[model samples]
Target: MKKGMTWLAAMAVCVTLAAPAQAADPIKIGVQGAQSGDLASYGVPSLNAVKIVVDEANAKGGLLGRTIEVVAQDDQCKPEMATNAATKLISDKVDAVVGPICSGPTKASLPMFQEAALIAVSPTATTPGLTEDGKNPLFFRTVANDNAQASLTSDFMLNNLKVKKVAYLHDNGDYGKGFADKNREIMEKGGTETVLFEAVTPDAVDFSAVVRKLRRAKPDIIVFGGYQPVASKLLQQMRRDNLKTPLIGPDGVKDETFLKMTGKDSEGTYASYPKDTSTLPEYKKAREAHIKAFGSEPGFGYYNAYAAAQCLLAAMEKAGSTDTAKIKDVLRENQVDTPLGKLSFNAKGDAAGMGLSIYQVKDGKFVELDHSIVLE
Candidate 1:
């Protein structure tokens, strides 16, 4: 009888040891990004920023005493890839999802997220259609949309700089096309004439043809609705061909990589962006922490991604449960204090009371040129 009791006691100890492991299951969060495509610069850094936040959160005993696990997937800036990634994350039952950084991928994959009842917060997807659709209550974005940026950019070009005629160029993609359309609409509404509007394939290496067209039109300013890769090449080729009009662009062209790609040619280019880090104390502290951790300043997508993750975690904590419905409600109603300051979502899940800031590339660096111009 004593020998039997000893065996049972040993089994009890084994069960107790296994219980801790089972109780410590990591709360998984899905993170999707274009880790291997044209937009990798934006995706990779944003993923790294998410990691930084996850690490910091875990170090603080994690959420609800459970460690956070970020399940990262590469969407490669493709819609199909984004859909597959979203499906896989949904099947895996992640508590929340962070991105599909580019707008094309974000728009393509949003339906899957909605069907799966997952809370998705995009760090960089700024296309207006994502939130304006009125179909997906779960879709949220930390970045300002193209409509807001385009309005402010139009005002800056028309009212401030007093450019009466503007030429608009965009890469033929959802992001580029959407911003170009919005900018044209706003500029025309403000009584400014858009002399030339054109869309070029993002991979086009020869922009002399477009430059010739622009030169023929002879607008005072050229507004580019695209990211750095195309913008840099276009600007460089324009310079080589001696097209000397001032360039204006949206947030996609505001990164340091744009200057690096275009070199001296990037000088005098103007860009519209959300609030700069220099103006926020919380952002300054976050920037210092990020530099210390990653050995460089956080890029545009980095801080935004971190803020998105912080917002998700804050909502999770407020809901006190991993239930998606409760979490979504918490996200919509609660104000999250993140590295970017107090962020609150509207009924549409878009950031509320946010504005865009204008920057100018002077000496190959983006310098904040004006104060925040409120849109709504």
Candidate 2:
């Protein structure tokens, strides 16, 4: 009996020693975005969406019996800042990351993330090359690449808008420039003339000179490739210069910030964004929680961010471990029903079925023009 008691005490000591490993503090989730700067509206919403998701997840007793914590790092949508964000997250020992929103930033920092064996799910990075040839196996996204978006835009401009000559303007960054180039290529292939292709300095507040050049081009439509700040300023300057040509844009300018900036001038402006799933229960729940917390509708990429965070958390649960490799496998194989609907990733890390849809500024807000523009 004495020997048995001594052995039992030793066993109890072993159990106590092992408890801490099993009950390690909350799992850390890193969220990277343009938390502050000219693109604050674009980035803050992604953080807010993740916060809402994190809160809901914690409320439900967390995932895999471990509470989740968000470690947000702001990249400010700059390439240099993005590398810094990745370094900090690596130091933080986060299990996964949600974004580095801009394509330039995402491209600059992805190698660091890959080296760290950290899994990432971008809510808005849409460059085509990011996922090609399975280069970044650790990287995944809830957004479609710009290649598909470009195809859709070409079809829309050719078939729906029926424009012949178009002007192309870009911010010269990876996302903006790549999207603009793709659009020009597609439109040219369809026999539409690209009258002018120009890159504007993204930070320049005065675009009157560029607007002047655009006016001389006399394009039927202007395709602006960049975020709302530049787009808004360009549109404002174009209108002020009496160039009433309709300016169409991509997801970067689809936010309410663009609408607020352009005001009356925003009318008839078109942009392509992820298809709306506002009617779905998953989407409704997220929106309700966002409004309850933030007192307004969620901003651009909010739903996509929600979907991203949910995908990460769900993959962790499905894999039954925080091991990124296993979670990555689950992410590929399992379908997660997020605010974006049933979501799964391909080998290239792009989300399946999350195609771009057209939205137009109607009555001071962006309203869905068409969601069924499928491109081969």
Tens-place lDDT per residue, model 2, 87-178, is 99999999999998888899998999999999999999989999887888999988877888787777899999899999999998888888
Q: TM-scores of the models, in the given order? A: 0.94, 0.94
Q: Itemize residue pairs with steric clashes in candidate 2.
A: none
Compute the lDDT for candidate 2: 0.88
Off by over 4 Å in 1: 1-20
> lDDT tens digits, residues 107-178, model 1?
888888888888889988889888885887889988888888888888788778988888989987888888
lDDT of 2 at 232: 90
Give the TM-score comparing model 1 with the true structure, all chains together.
Answer: 0.94
